[model samples]
Target chain A: MVVDKMLYNLGRYVNLLRDAIARPEKFSMYYKETMRQMDAIGVGSVFIVLLISVFIGMVTAVQFVDQLGDSFVPSYYIGYIVRDITIIEMAPTITCLVLAGKVGSNLAAEIGGMRQKEHIDAMEIMGVNTAAYLIMPKIIAAVVVIPMLVAIAAFVSIVGGYVSTVLPGSLSHTEYVLGLRSFFVPRYVFMMFVKAAVFAYLITSVSCYMGYYAKGGSIELGEASTNAVVVSSVLILVFDFLIALLLT
Target chain B: MIRTENITKTFGDNDVLKGISTEFYAGKPNLIIGSSGAGKTVLLKLLIGLFKPTSGKVYYDDVDLFSVDDDALREVRMKLGMLFQGNALFDSMTVGENIRFPMDMFTNRTLGEKEKRVDECLEMVNMEGINDRFPSEVSGGMQKRVGIARAMVLEPKYLFCDEPNSGLDPKTAILIDELICDLTNRNNITTVINTHDMNSVMGIGDNIVLLKDGHLVWQGDKSQVLESEEAVLQDFIFASPFLRRLREDALKQRHAHD
Candidate 1:
């Protein structure tokens, strides 16, 4: 029964996306909505993304340094480990997981509220395609902005490692800088962007689907918001594993 | 004109609208009234093509609503407007922006032209100026009026209102009814309203259809409501004890005069 319900929902979600990508009624209107979403999703999320990313790098640096005690591995391996880990996993995955909670839940609640209030119906009656108008701009904005955020997260996390290590006198600044420059692969950067884009699409689309079909009242809206975050987080982790398996 | 041919709607195991046929004419306030569980809303949604009937068909004049392609259906919908039970005004926008939305989406009108049309619609609803205020800042009656203004801003050929006076004082409810009635007559648009307000029924109900458990049990104008012998109609319209006593007293006084 659970599998059947999941399949049904998956089918419906695909169909909704098909409808959501249709030609917009007016280019100007769609452009305006897209710009608004860019501001909300991109500009509004920078602070939280930066905060979480810095902490992720700090924790990784501190923990790895302690674990390296008496080991033959060079102390500067901490910088190399932090750089590679942030690029390969922490930057895209952790940043998006945070966004799934913040931006994803918010998208679900906003759209669910509109559905409950019949604003979507009002737009439909006006011959404006409601799904396309509401969902497409959000998707577009997220796709464009989330990768940039992940890039910033990657940079900030490396800086955080430097601050935690170099400023604490545990590791020499020259050694940490040497470790940062050592063995950097350009392909890993490519992998990071790919993961960022895929995760961004998953979070926004899943949240939007939850919201678009939300029924009943306030309780249902709350459920939709929670489901959006939960479902998107799970999908991100699952895809993270899959991408790691396929890419590495 | 809009007509439904034995339309039916079912949700899972529950059937909301049974096989029922009805017609709403243009240039009149066609009211649909029923108790809480009746199929009035389902039927209204079917007419607007929001819900596809499980069995039957809905026709906007000669065009079958469900039979048309998406593009064709959208073309038909462009001529339509609706006022929701909760007014459904965009909370983020000012009154002028909300009214200008449909125009902005569908027309190539200049900003000046759109502003002129917005003012005209607000004036038609007797809510001139105050264009910069948000919906939350307005009173309930004013919100309903602004909703009406937004719905009519597109100058649609058909207007559907779901409970236009659901939450309002009795005096304000009558005023809204009169305003809707006046607009319907002036525009000669096909206006269908779903309402449970008795004052609205007797005041502007040019044509009324009553539904009970998805069946069209009664149909008539306001004049026939007082004389209606249909038990369902009487039970619904005079549900309150005070109205029933009033009805009985009026009948007794009429017999005494005779």
Candidate 2:
């Protein structure tokens, strides 16, 4: 019974996305909405992403320093480890996981509110494709902007590693820099962006789906928002593993 | 005109609308009225293609609403405008933006032209200016007016209002009814209103369909209301003892005068 219900929902979700990912009625209207979404999803999330990324780097460097005590592994390996972990995994995965909580829930609530308030019905009556108008721009904005955020997270985490280690005199500046310079693979950056894009798609599409078909009242809307975040977070992790396995 | 032929709807085991056939003529305000759970809303939604009937057909003029393709349905929908019970104005947008949204989505009209039409719609609703105000900043009555303005902004040929007077002062409700009546007559448009407000029923119900327990029990104009011998209509419109006494007194007076 549970599997049947899941399949039913999956079918509905796919149909809803099929409607949403159609050719837009007008370019200018979609462009204007996409830019607004870009501002909200990209610019609005910068501070939290930056704050979390900094802490992520700091904790990684500090923990590595403690573990490397009196070991034959050189001190600079801290920089190498932090740089690789951040680039290969932490930046895209952690940043997007946090965004799933923040932006995903918000998107779900917004669309769900519209549904409850009859705005979607009104638009449908007006000949506007409600699914396309509501969801497409959000998807576009997240796709375009989330990868950029992931890139910034990568850079910031490395800087955080430098600040935590070299500034505290736990490791010399030159050694840390040397460690960062070593074992730098361009393919890892490509993998980070690929993960970022895939996660962005997952978070936005799932959240929009939760909101679009949401029924009942405020309680249902709250559940939809919670589901958006939880579902997106889980999907992000699952996809992260899949992408890592495929790309590696 | 819009016509439904034996339309019915069922949700789970509950049959909300049981085989209703009716016609809503243009150039007048057609009303769907009934007691709570009478399937008035369900019938209205069916007429508008928002809900598909279990076994029936809806014809918008000559076009079958259910048999049409999506593009054809969309083409039909382009001529439709609806005012929801909650008004359904976008809270984030100014009144002007809400009004212009349909035009923005479907038309290539210039901004100047769209603004002019927006102002004209607002004026038609007797709410000139106030375009910059968000929906949250306005009173409930003002929101209804804004909703009407947005609905009529595209000059739709078919207008559907679901309980347009649901939460408003009597005076405001009358004003809205009058505005809707005038617009219907002036534009020769099909206006279908689902309402339970007695003032609206007796005031502007050019044609009325009454539903009871998913069956359309009575159909007539306001003039036929007091004179009709349908027990269901009698019990519905004069459910209160005071009103029933008044109805009996009026009937006696009419007979005596005759």
Q: What shift in Å separates residue B201 of candidate 1 from its native position after superposition?
A: 1.1
Per-residue alpha-carbon lDDT of candidate 2 for residues B1-258, written as tens digits (9 for 90 to 100): 999999889999999988899999999999999999999888888877778899999999999999998778888999998999999999899999999999999999999999999999999999998999999999998999999999998888999999999889999999999999999999999999999988888899899999999998899999889899999988888889999898899989999999
**lDDT by residue for model 2 (A1-248), tens:** 99998899899999998898777888899999999999999999999999999999999999999999679998889999999999999999999999999999999999999999999988888877888999999999999999999999999999999999999899999999999999899999999999999999999999999999899999999999999999999999999989989999
lDDT of 1 by residue, B1-258 (tens): 999899889999999988888899999999999998899998888888889999998889999999999989999999998999999999999999999999999999999999999999999998999799999999999999999999999888999999998889998988998899999999999999998888888898889999999899999999888878999999999999999999889778877998
Q: What docking class should model 1 receive?
A: high
Error of 1 at B89 (Å): 0.9
- State the DockQ, from 0 to 1, for candidate 1: 0.82
Real A-B contacts recovered, model 2: 0.82
The lDDT, on a scale of 0 to 1, for candidate 1 is 0.93
Clash pairs, candidate 1, are none
Q: Measure candidate 2: CA RMSD.
A: 0.9
TM-score of chain B of 2: 0.98
Q: Distance from true position, residue B205, model 2, in Å?
A: 1.2
- TM-score of the second chain of model 1 compared to its true counterpart: 0.97
Calculate each model's fnat, 2 decimals.
0.85, 0.82
